[model samples]
Target: MIFTIARKEFRSLFAAPSTWWMLALMQFLFAWFFFVRIDDYLQVQAQLTQLANAPGSTIAVASPLYSALALMLMLLIPLFTMRLIAEERRNRTWVLLLTAPVSVTHIVLGKFLGLMLLLVLIVAGSAIMLVTLLLGTHADLGLMLANILGVLLLSASYAALGLYFSALSKQPVIAAIGALGMSFGLWLLELSASDNRSFLRAISPNAHFQNLNMGLVNSADLIYFMLFTATLLWLTIRQLNDERRSS
Candidate 1:
């Protein structure tokens, strides 16, 4: 049943013209940043070569590209997730979904999985661009894998957070704005900390992602993302259950 809902949600996304436009925009932005990174690397290649512990093309180019991609997706995800549940509520379909035979958990998980499938497409586009680096220079496969993992977790966090807001509001625009505000607020929290060891910095997704972007895959960061996503999903489920009981 979850798979059925997931497939339906995934297909519905493609049925909309906005999905196509978003995909195109994502690629265009990625390509522009990629070329800029290459140009910057080329200009500094000579100076880097003179240093004994110079960073390679992978660190110099690929790392920053993934970091930029992460930030870009951080902004774009709220737009994508805005309609997940909010649209249903606005269209008066929320009652039908709640009355369906499927459990609230399945509905929420299905929607999350659907969003994740779209995220895979976005990540794959960037991965292809990253792989091209291997043709001209030696790339760090380990670092690349770490970066991929980091971005996936980060993107999942964004989806989960947006999903909760989507469930909270009937209007898609309001959901988008609320999600964006919270996402940006968390980012600001990370930036406002006076020290790296501050509790505020520790709680922000950006700090953990930075560790992974640098290829340091700590257990704590992995745990943070999992807990963060699970908490949001759980809240979404509870919200739907309450709505069901009331209706």
Candidate 2:
């Protein structure tokens, strides 16, 4: 049942022409960034090589590319997730879903999984672009794997946050705006903190994302992402359950 709902959401997203346009824009943006990174690396190759502990092409290129995509995901995910529940409510389909045989957890998790499939595609595209470096230079596979894990967790967090906001309103625009505001604010919080020990920074997913981005797999960061995503998903489930009971 969850898989059925997931497929339905996935198809619905792709059925919209805007999704295609958004993907095309993403490809263009990624291509441009990929080339820019390669160019910069080439320009400073001499200086980089002379340094005993200089970063390789993988760190110079792939790391920053992943970081850029991570930033882009912060914006893209809200738009993608805005319609998950808000659209259904706006179209008067929310009651039908609420009355369905499946539990609220199935509906919410299905939608979350559907959105994640799309995000996984985006991550794959970025990975392919990053892997192109292997044709000309040695790349750090470990760092690349860590980056992939980081971005997946980060994108999932964005999706979970947006999903919760989507459950709060019938207006997709409001949902999108609320999700984006919260996401961008948390991101800025990470940037605002001067020390790693600050509680404000601790609340932001981006702070933990940075540790993974550096290829440092700390158990605390893993726990943070898991707990963060689980909390949002649980909240989304509770919201739907309340709606079901009230209806």
Candidate 3:
């Protein structure tokens, strides 16, 4: 039953012209950045070779591109997450979902999963550009895998937060603004604070993503992401239940 709901939600996303337009815009931005980074890397190849006479010099050369890609992802995720639930509510489709035989948990999970799946495809598509770089240069497979995992986990956290906010509002524009404001605010806090605020840093998804990007998979970081995602999902479920009861 959950899968059925998820399939419907996933299909709805594809059917929506706005979703495709956003996806097209994202792809264009990704491609443009990729080309610019590759071109910059090529220009600096000579300088890097002069500085380091190492076997993995090409991998070192590609580090800047990876960093740029990560930054772009951080900016892009919230936009995709904005409409997941808010649009349904704004269109009055959420009432239909509430009256369905499926449990609130199932509905929330199904939607979350569907968004995650779409995010996975977006991530995978961006990765193809990275893979193309590997053809002529030696890249670290393990490092690349770690980067991908970090991206997925980071995206999951954003999606969960977006879902929660979507449940809180019936206006899709309000939901998008709220989600972006919260995400950007959290990111800014993580960036602006000193190391003395390590406790606060641990709570930010961007902080954990930094560790993952460095190829350091700490269990604590994984747990933080899991807990963050789970808490928001639970909040969304509660919100749905409360709405149904009130209705």
Q: Could you say which candidate leads in lDDT?
A: 2
lDDT of 2 by residue, 1-247 (tens): 8999999999999999999999899889989999999999999999988999999998888888888899999999999999899988999898888887999999999999999999999999889888888899899999999999999999999999999999998999999999999999999999999999999999999999998888999899899999999999999999989988988
Query: Which 10 successive residues of model 1 have the least lDDT summed?
Result: 93-102
TM-scores for every candidate against the unseen true structure: 0.98, 0.98, 0.91
The TM-score obtained by model 3 is 0.91
Native-to-model Cα distance after best TM-score fit, residue 59 in candidate 3, in Å: 5.5
| Model 2 weakest lDDT span, ten residues long | 125-134
Candidate 2, residue 105: CA error in Å? 0.6
Model 2: number of backbone collisions: 0
Task: Sort the candidates on lDDT, descending order.
Answer: 2, 1, 3
Worst 10 residues of 3 by lDDT: 54-63
* TM-score result, candidate 1: 0.98
- lDDT, candidate 3, equals 0.78
Whole-model lDDT values for every prediction: 0.93, 0.93, 0.78
